[model samples]
Target: MPQRLIASVLLGHYLSAFTTLGIPLYLPRILADLAPDAPGWSIGVLFILPTLCTALAAPLWGHLADRHGCRLSLLRAHAGLCAGFLLAGFSPNLTVFVLALMIQGTFGGAMAASNAYLATQLKDGNLSRALNWTQYSARLAMISGPILLGLLTASGMGLELYRVLAWLPLLAFVLILPLPADAPRRQARTSDGDGDEWPDQLPNDLPRLLAVQFLFSFAMVVTFPYFVPYGEALGVGNDALIGLLYSLPHLVYLVALPWAQRQAANLLLPGLGLLALTNALQFWSDQPDLLFTLRLLSGAGMLLGFVGLHRCLSQRSRNGSAGRLFGWYDSSGKWAGAAAGVTAGLVSQSCGIASPFLVAGLVAFAALVLARPLLIAPREITA
Candidate 1:
C-alpha cells in the first residue's frame, strides 16, 4: 500500500463526490433559470433521475472493473465524467443538460472501481483504515463543493456559474491521470470456463451484509433529498449553512472512524442503533430550535452508521471474495438509495416534505431493530 496509491484513490473519491455535490447545489438554480414555473413534482423528478441512473449503472461498471483492468476502467470513467461536466456546463437547453447527466451516470461507478484498486493494493491490516480515510476525503469533497458553489451562485456571476463548477471535474481529471493502475489481477476474469469471471459461490454472509447496507441506505435516502427544504420551512434559509448542517454529522463520523475501528472491534450494531435514533429524532422535530438539534444528533448517528458499515465491508472483503461481495454491497446500497429517492420525492409531492422524514425515521428505527440479528453471527470467509 504505497502512500501515492492511497492518495490517488482518495483524490478520485474527492473529485467524484465534488462533481456529484455540485449537481444538487446548482439544481435549484438550474430549475430557476431553465424551468421557472416548474413545480415540486418536476424538481422531484429531476432529483430522482441521477440516482436512478447511477443505481442502474453501478453494477455494470463494477463488473467491468472486475473483468477488465481497474486502471483502464477508472481512466475511462474519469474521461466520461470530464465529458459529462462539459456537457452539463455547456448545454443549450434543459433536455441536453439532463441527458448529459444521464451519461454521467453511465460512468458513475468509477468510485467503486477506484475502491477495488485500493483494496487490491492495500495490506490487510491497513485496508479498513484506508477506506475510512477515503470516505473522509469524499465527505470533505461533498462539504466543499456545495459551499463553494453556493458562494459562487450567491455572488451572481450569472452564466459563469457553469464554468466555475466545471473546474472541479476538470481538476479531478488532471489529478487522476498520473495515478498508478491496478496490475492485472490473475489475468482478468473472463467468460465461459475461464474461472475468470467474478466469483460464483458468494458466501451466504455476503447477502446478509448487502441487505444491511440496503436498509441503512434506504433510511438515508428517505430524508436526504427533503431535508434542505424542511430546514428552510423551519426558517434556516441559507444554502451554505444548511449544507454545513447536513455535513456536520459526517464530520463527526470522520473524526470517530479511526478511534472506533481501533477500540470497538465490531461497530456495526451500535452504529445502526445510533442511526435509528437519529432518524427518529428527525421524524418528530419541526420547530426551528428542535430541528437543528435533531439534525446535529442525526449527523452524529450517521457518522457511526456509515463508517461502521464501511469497516464491516472492508473486513468482509479480506476473506477472498472482494469483487463480488463489494459489488453486491454497492449495488444493494445504490438500489436502496434510488428507491428512497423516488419514494421520498413522491411522498413529498403528495404529503408535504416533512412526511418523508417522518416515514424515514420509522424505517430507520425498524432497520435498527433488525440489524442486531444480522450482525450477531460469527464472521464467515469465502475460499
Candidate 2:
C-alpha cells in the first residue's frame, strides 16, 4: 500500500473534523452576536443535528458505493462538503447556519466511503493498524481545531476562524484531484450469482456488531459534546482548560489505539472495562482533576473498543459487502451520536450538565455488559 493514499485519506478526515468542530466550539461566540436567544445547551443541540443528517445519509452513500465505485462517491462527497463548509462560514442567519451544517453532514459519509476504499486496498492483517493510523489523523485534527480556535478567541478576532476552517475542506477538494480510485474487484459480481452469492458473503455476526456499535457510539458521542460543560460545572471554566480537558481523552487515546489495533479481539473486555471505569469516575467525582483523569480513562476505553470493532468488521470486507457493512456501521454510529448529542444536551439544559454525564455513564456501563456476548461468540471472518 502506498503511504500517499493513506495520507490522502487522512487529509480528508482531518479537514472534515476540523471544520465540523469549529462550528460547535465557535457556536458560543457566534451565538453571542447573532442568536442571543440560543442558549449554550441549545447550541449543543444545534451542533448535533448535522451529525443526525450525516447518520441519515451514510447508507445512501454506502449503497451507491456498493453499486458504483467508492472512488467516485468519495469525490462527489468531498465536493459537496467543500460547498457546505463555505455556506457555514458565511451564514448570516441561524437558519442558514443550520442548513449549511446539514449539507456538510449529508456528505459526511465520505469518511465511510474512504474507509471502504482503504479496506479494499490494504491486506487483511494490516487493516486494523491502518485504520488506527487513519483515525489518529481525525483525532489530531479534533485536538488542533479547538486549541487554535481558543487562541483566536483570546486574540478577539475569532469570528473569522470559521473562514479559516472552511479553507481546509476547500484545500481537500484540490488535493483529491490526483488520487486514483480503488479499482473495482467485484464489478460484475452479484449477491444472487452463484459465483458471488452476497448473502453467503455477509457476516453472520452483523446484527450483534451493529448493536455493539450503537452502544459504544451512543456512549461516546453523548458524553463527548458535554465535556466542556462538565468541566465548567466542576469549576474549571477557562476555555483553554476546557479545551485541555476535552483533549485529554484523545491524547490518551492516541497512546492506546495503536497497541489495541495490534491486539484485536483480545482487547475487547479490557476496552469495555475502561469505558465502565470512565463512567464510574463520573458517577463518583466532583473534582476537576479526578474527572479529567476519568475522561482520559474513558478515551482509552474508546480507543480499545473502536480498534477492536473496526478490526472485527474489517475482517468482513472480503465477504463482498464491505461497503454496505461499513456504511451501516457509519450510519448506526452517527445516529447514535445524534441521539446522544440531543439527549445529553437537553438533559443538561433541563437538569444539569453533571446529570447527563452520570446518566449516560450508566447507559455506557449497560452497553459494556451487553457487549460480552458478541465478543465471545465464534462465527465468521471476512476481511
Candidate 3:
C-alpha cells in the first residue's frame, strides 16, 4: 500500500485512456476522410465494434495474470496500447485502421490490469479506497482525454499525431515498470490469511456479482447516447451547458468522493434507484434547471453504485484471482455498455431521443432489485 505505487497506477491508468478512447471520439472525422462512401450506420457499428472485442477478450487478460503475474500483465496492457496506437497512427487504409482499432480494444485494458494489481497489493477498506481513486483517474481521463488529444491531432487522426500519442501508453509502461513485484505484496497479504481464501470466497456467487455489474453498468451508461440531445430537447441552447449536463455524473465522482464512499452501502440501492428515477424524470421535465438537477442527482447515484459494486467484486481478490475476476468484471461492464448503446440507438430511432432514458430507468429499477443484497453490510465485507 505504498502511496507512490498507488499514485503511479492512477497516473498510468489516466494515460491509457487517451489511446483507448480515441477511436470512439474521433471516428466520424476519421471515417469521413478515409471512407467517405461508407454508409452512416456503419459508423455506429464500428464505434461499438471495438468495445465488443474488448468484452469478448477481457477474460483472457485474467488468465494471463494468473500465469504470469500482475506486474507483467499491466506492463503488457500498456505496451499493447502503445502498439495499437502506433498501428492506427500508421494505418494506410480503412481496413488497417479498423484492424488497428480492434487490436487496441483486444489488447488494451490498463484499467482492469491496474485493478488486478491493486487488488493483489491491498485488502479490505484500503483496497476499496484505492479502487475509488482509480475511478477518479478514469473519469478525468474519459472527460478530458479526447479534448486534449483532439487538440494535439487537430482532430485529424493522422500518422504523426497518433504516433506521438503512442508515447503516453509507453510512458505508462515505464511508470509501472518501476513498481515492486506482485509476489512480495501478495505474500504479505497471504500471510494474513487473505491469500489462503478461495477465489470464489466472495459475498455471493461470481456469476451473480457479474450480473449486477452488467445491469448496473447498463443502467448508468444508457444515458450516454442522448444526454446532449436531451438537453437540447429541454431548450438548453448553450453548447457548454449541454456538455456540462453530460459531464455532471463524472464530476460528481470527483466532488463527492468522500461522502459517497462513506455512504456507498446506503447509496448503492438509492443510486440504482436514482438512475431509474432520473431517466424516468427526463420525460417529466423540459425545464433546463430541473434537468440539470436531475443530472446532478444521477451523478451522485452513479458514484455510490459504482463504488459499492467494485467493493463487492474486490473481495474476490482473497484467493489471488484478482486478474481474472477483474478481467471478467471489466467484460461484463463493456458488454452491458455496448448493449445499452445499441439498444439506445434502436429505441431512439423509433421512440424519440428521450425514450432511452425511460428504458434505462426501468433497467435501473430492475438492477436495484437485483443488487440489493450485496449492498447490505454483512460478514462477507472483510472476506
On lDDT, the leading prediction is 3
The sequence of per-residue lDDT tens digits that candidate 3 reaches over residues 1-383 is 38999999999998887667653677777777767888998888888877888898879987677556788889988998898889878887888978887888888888789988998778877788888888898888878877776786584444556688789999999999989776533453455564444443334467767888898888877778877787788789898878878888989988898877775344567778877888789866767788878889888888888888767765556535677778888999999999999888888889988888888888888888887776553535233
The candidates, ranked best first by lDDT, are 3, 2, 1
- Error (Å) of candidate 3 at residue 165 is 1.6
* Better by lDDT, candidate 3 or 1: 3
- What TM-score fits each model? 0.83, 0.86, 0.91
In candidate 3, where is summed lDDT lowest over 10 consecutive residues?
194-203
**After best superposition, candidate 3 residue 250: deviation in angstroms?**
1.0
lDDT value for model 3: 0.79
Give the count of colliding residue pairs in each prediction.
Answer: 2, 4, 0
Q: Write the per-residue lDDT of candidate 1 for residues 214-279, one digit (tens) a residue.
A: 888888767877778877987887986777777767777666666666755556666667667766
What shift in Å separates residue 383 of candidate 1 from its native position after superposition?
10
Per-residue lDDT over 1-383 for candidate 2, one digit per residue giving the tens place of the 0 to 100 score: 36888788778767766777655767778767667777566776666777788888887777777666666667767776777767776888788877877888887556686677677667566666677776787678778877777778788754456666667776766666677765443652543355544432557777778887887877777767677767777889698778777777788877776566656245666787778667767856877778667777878887887777766766666524556777888888888877787788688888777776666667667767776766667656343
Model 3 error, position 346 (Å) = 1.0
How many angstroms is residue 324 displaced in model 2 relative to the true structure, after the best TM-score fit? 1.9
lDDT of 1 at 63: 60
Model 1 lDDT, residue 40, Cα: 61
